[model samples]
Target: MKTKLTRRLLCGLIAAPALLWAGVQAHAADIKERTLRFAFVQPKESHMGYGAQKFADLVAQKSGKKMQVKLYPNGTLGGDLQTVSALQGGTIDLTTMPPGLLVGLKKEFGAFDLPFLFNDFAEADAVLDGPVGKQFMERLPNGLVGLAYWDHGFRNVSNNRRPIAKAEDFEGLKLRALQAPLMIDTFKALGANAVPMAFTELYAALESRAVDGQDNPIVAFATNRFDEVQKHLSTTRHVYNPLMVMASRKAWDSLSADERKVLMDAANEARIEQRRVSREMEAKALAEIRKKGVLVTEVSPQERERMREKVKPVTDKYVKEIGEDVVSSFHAEIDKVRTAR
Candidate 1:
């Protein structure tokens, strides 16, 4: 009886190791070696570029060098709009774009385009990382899968006309606003003649006096060298642009469960590093813009309030369009973050 018991114990131990080995093999089998193409508008030196490279490195490492990401930067694949359309058509694998650009795909995404919606990164992060943002991403059409949100920093207004220290200064200024309705309406309500245009055409427009000014993050102004064409920079901090990293439904559906995990994990890890570098570079960029002899104005809190009041109608109009529950949940999440501090 003792001899029989010993043999059974040995057999059970051996089977346990075999079972574990089989599970590992099954997990590894799900990861197929394939290359994914990632496209973005920024150059290799920008935060977005760094994040893309980091994502590539992590994907390769985690997938045992089996899965790779090929990058196309500097809008090599075309503008933000083109990139999204390509993703839906399976011509592109992945891309990161401002949520405002997603408004055409899903009007609910316009909630993020609302100026002054988030007071700071903490609030923005809380709302975006919470349920509301997740639900919004899940609702995207045409197989677009939102993996994570990265920071584009707070957007400020810059122009060749004059310093925008107050809302009244926006009068008659031809500002190159984003093609999104909320963006166009925001500037319009502030009394500027908002000219909707593509980002690729912006520098030439500003230089040729087609548009008097434009609004973007300081990093963009510095990186794109807008300071050379525009004479004034106002730290309006009007909009907090959240960059959304997305995957094509065609590409994503083809991936195995284990492969999807690797991609999502790398995207989130890159997001942390991207936001850190973006905030750091934004500070340096603003200082450099000042040194370039561009007039920099810090809009006072009172003046900002006035500007906010001016755009209240635009905000109110979009609230119903963006849906009541989602925006309400967003405000609640933001309020939670604010009170947490």
Candidate 2:
């Protein structure tokens, strides 16, 4: 579970721009802008792609054809890492992506990857939608603009090898990671030899035995075609990934205030739609993944708890590597959740 980003994050990200552009009056005249491109990875049927399409539709309707958001899905925009860089460089206008990828842009984000941090989706929503969420959002302006967070759901383990009934089953296996440092460390703690690689390259990597296993939400695994390679499905639910939608600050400034409102509202609408759809789709995806000839390994609760206890040090080291306050705030949020009931 990641510590929430507070309003401080919201304010920081919207902090005063250094210098205003001169041609705002001229740009305002052209209210009928042709099209705006929103990028996402995965195929059109995946949550990322579907939500992006919904967002585009929202913006089109709200703006009365003044602007259109064209979606470039299925890596047509590029891989996770490449697309984020493109957004920062203003080569891309918008994108829906996993927040874990943003950790490279800000180490504080690693706090989100701590093992056993969140118990369920409700608790996660409480932190992210509250001050903690706003605080995390604020940190993005230093590198990229922060938008609403979309759920990627609980991450489970899948492999063609033996059943991971306990932490020991993961030992010596090479697991694919989203090229993030914390994930590499997480798999290492689980006794798996972790391989950090691009998301787009993961399928081929697994098929070729370049990596033996990968962890992801069920929807993502099936959507990305990894089900075709590795045949084992382990519902380890090790992580809860949330998608971050952002716009290029440079591209943002080029639009009129009204134009920006249309885009922002569209993004927010997309965020909500994406979360609902993912919440619904994961079960079907899980069922479908099971039908696709992959063995589903379910880790018992006792063993899952044992794995969490064993990974305590991974959490500790990351707390220091990220920031103590970030970790503290997360624990504090959990405390509130525990006290709530």
Q: Candidates' lDDT values, in order?
A: 0.88, 0.80
Candidate 1, superposed: residue stretches over 4 Å from native = 1-29
Per-candidate clashes come to: 0, 13
Minimal lDDT window, size 10, model 1: 19-28
**Candidates in order: C-alpha RMSD to true structure:** 9.1, 10.4
TM-score of 1: 0.90
Q: For model 1, how does the per-residue alpha-carbon lDDT over 198-300 read when each residue is reduced to its tens digit?
A: 7878889999999999999888888888988999999899999988999999999999988898899999998999899999999898889889999999999
Candidate 2 wrongly placed segments (more than 4 Å)? 1-30, 141-143
